[model samples]
Target chain A: MLYLQVLINGILLGGLYSCIAVGFSLVWGVLNIINIMHGSLIILGAYAAYFAFTLLGINPFVFVPIAGVALFVLGYALQAGVINRVMGAPVLITLTLTFGLNLILENAMIFAFKADYRKVIIDPPLGLIEIGSAFVPRDRLYAMLLALLLVGGLYAVLRTTRIGRAIVAVRMDREAAALMGVNVPRIYAITFGLGALMAGSAGSLMSVIFPISPLTSVAFLGKAFVICVLGGLGSIPGVMVGGIALGVLESFGSLWLGPDYSTTIAFVLLLALLMFRPTGIMGKRGFE
Target chain B: MTGGRLLMAVAAAAMVGALPFMADNYILRIATSMLMYATLAMSWNFIGGFAGYPSFATAAFFGLGAYAGAVLQTKGVPMIAAWIVAGMIVTVFAAAVGRAILHLRGHYFAIASLVIADVLREVINGMTNLTGGGMGLNLPVLKIDVTTQAQFFYCAMLAVALLALATSVILDRSRVGFGLRCIEQNEDAALRLGIHTSRYKTIAFSLSSVYPALAGAVYASWVSYIDPAEAFDVLFSIKPIIMALLGGAGTIVGPVVGAFIFQVMEELVWRNFLNVHLGLLGLIVVLLILFLPKGLLGIGLLSPRGRPLTAKAP
Candidate 1:
């Protein structure tokens, strides 16, 4: 029964993990650049949700799309105006640029919203649903469901839509896509927007379940990097698999090794995986 | 070398060397920390700037050195011996790990290094008997107070920084430096031209780790306390990279210049700006990234366009 509970918890946690990973992975897939400030951006989304709840009195669920859309536009402009200029520069330049952006965003958030932690007062119905011999909280179950839906929706959009094809095309061959008359820059911007939007949605969901703070992004950034590496940079479905594996590992690792090691496990796993298997699960080999 | 330039450098070093004697305790303290940071940044440039492999595990190596020193102190070793042993240990670990993980490229190597840092910290935390778990460890003073210790650490750090600069300048003109540049530009071509890319990178990686380890040892000794968080702080990893980038990576003076400028800026912000300092720092990085991707000393300022700047001392 304990094992069952662990599995269910892991699966649920994995859903949220997938949400975080997919956003980061999408950005990596499309732009060939690691968005170092991604975690900070997610925290920004969480803060947005907090404001929506406290000031505007809107439901946290209702604020998801609103925050997502706003972040999308912001990400679009960032890529279009700034990142595009140094698209093909050395990787060090990209690293320095994004790293600087991360510092700026993190510090900006800290200044704008003080270091105090905030959480949305959901006041949810504290009911538990019995599944076989295990019980699950309604809140967690809802969060898990929403995360799954978002991942599925994102996967579908990428797999089935015309814009999605363009994105995949660009990722595969930027020059070829441009030669094929695709507006590569526009597609790149949209992909970045979508990636940031997914992160915003993850943030909104996370605010309801976890305490929100500007610093929370730093922790999640570490987690997201682990997941993206595990799942492979461009492989969307691999994120789901990676997330589930990490969530389970973390849950069990925390149970056995204490919570102190729980957070670091993901990073350790990430390094091990990267050293051994940079391609990640079900992903194309090399550079991604 | 021209006597004028040599004299100028010596004078500058002497002025900085005399700072602890002349300045207030606070200035001395911050200067000590700045030198530590400068050492770290310069060390990191050995790999990230020169060899083109940005290892985010720099904090891990630093933390390892700190812990090694701290652990040796518990075994009743003197601080200086502890620091030397710590540096050796970190050097070996970096060399071994670099040999294995340095095979990866770009972001792959980056994420791997980050993982190493996190993992090392966790592993250290798990050894509760040794590391004191999350509570951290405090060292018993054999015979030292905070101020004098800070002075000692400052001088040690300054010495290490000087060594790093010397090494960088040496490598800047050596055959290995040429090979590294070739590899950075085109690994395939470099390999085709008979460059031992892996060996060169490994040397750079081990060399890069030496100063951080030394700095970490001094920092732990001066503070007389160490913790997993303080030791493995990712912020340390990021700061050096930022400093290297800000001043210009691959240049001998870049990390030093970057560290000095950024540290002073950081001190000023922390002192006067209050809560908005983080925002300001972020803005600075973003602006730098957008405007000066080649770093503080770009082609336009330092050298003619499309010309390789590769001359050593006359």
Candidate 2:
């Protein structure tokens, strides 16, 4: 029963992780820029949620879309103005540019908010639910369900919408897409905006369960990379499986090998996976 | 290549060789540190700038050398012997590791190198009995005149820098150098051209590790103390790449110029803008990447203008 409970907790946490990583995977798959600033942007969303909770008595569940929209605008302008200029440079240049953006964002947050850990805590909405000798927190249950809904919505938008088809076409061949009358730059902006939205939503959801601090970005960045790599770029189902696997592995690792070492397990898994299975599980577009 | 160039090269070498008499202890210390780092950047350039595989394992090799030097020094081994032994150890390790891992492309290779650093750190931390674990190890400072000792290290480092530059120049002109360039341009075509791609890559990777190992050994001798965190710093691994990129990669003079620029800016930042130094530096790097994609040398700039000398028949 206790083991089952741990497994349930892992799956819930995995859902949150999947949400955090999908935006990153989407950006990498479409833009071909491994935006190192992603974790910093997620931190921005968490802070936005925290402030919303503090000032207006708004809960995280309500604040997520607000934060998501705000971040979408920020991400859109950033990509359109700064990042798009060097879109054709080597991968190293792209990596370095995002790294610089990360530094700016992190320091700006530090200057504004001070380096204090903040959390959005809500008084328990309702009592815990028990099913077959396993217990689940009401907040975690909601976060997990929300993750599923958001991913499904995103998947639908990409598959069914005209804009979605343009994005897919652009991903398939940017030059050909432009030749075919698709506005390539606009599609790029939309993808950046959408990726940021997912990160913002994940950040808002995550603030409730984890402490929000500037430095937490590094761990989340590592986690997102591990999750994305495991699932493979351009593979949505791969992310779901990857996220759950990482969460469970981390939970069991913490339980068995001591807590300090649990964090390193993701990085270790990432290295091993890249070495052994560079294509990633179910990856449609192989690694560059 | 004629009289003037030959004379300039000889004059520069002579000045560095005679620096022990003119430079003060403080200046010599800085020079020593600069040479060590320059060596590291050049080594990193062999794989990263030239081979087009950005590695993050220089720190691992450096830390490995430091620990090896520290252990050997504690056992009463001479300084020169410790440096050579440490370099050889890291060279062998790099060859073995690179054979298996360098096949991973792009950021996968970069991140794998990072993981290697972390794992090396973990292994060192776990082996408390050999490494003194987290606390680190100390070496007895050799009895010598303070001024001359500093100057000696400075000259020694200059020699290493010269050697590194020579190696790069040779590799740039050699068949292996041609092979590396072809591989960098396109691995599939290089394979079709019968360039034994993995063999060349592994050789480049192994050669790259040697300079960091030697420099780390020299650093241990200079500082007389070391720790796992300081030895295997991720920032240390990053600095050389930044220097290489800033100076203009894949060129002999680039890393050298980059090291000089980085050290000067770093010193200024430390002195003037203490809190936001990294932030500012980050901005500079981003701006460079966006605007000056070929870095300071402006290699990419030539393509747009299509000037007679710079233009290629692409």
After superposition, candidate 2 runs with Cα above 4 Å error: A124-127, A286-288, B2-15, B144-149, B299-314
What DockQ does model 2 achieve? 0.47
lDDT of each structure?
Answer: 0.81, 0.81
Name the lDDT of candidate 2.
0.81
lDDT (C-alpha) at residue A97 in model 2: 81
Docking class for model 1 is medium
* Residue pairs whose backbone atoms clash in candidate 2: none
Query: Could you report the Cα RMSD, in angstroms, for every candidate shown?
Result: 3.6, 3.5
**How would you encode candidate 2's per-residue C-alpha lDDT over B146-174 as one tens digit per residue?**
88678767776777787788898899889
True contacts kept of each: 0.73, 0.53
Worst 10 residues of 1 chain A by lDDT: A279-288
Worst 10-residue lDDT window for candidate 2 chain B reads B305-314
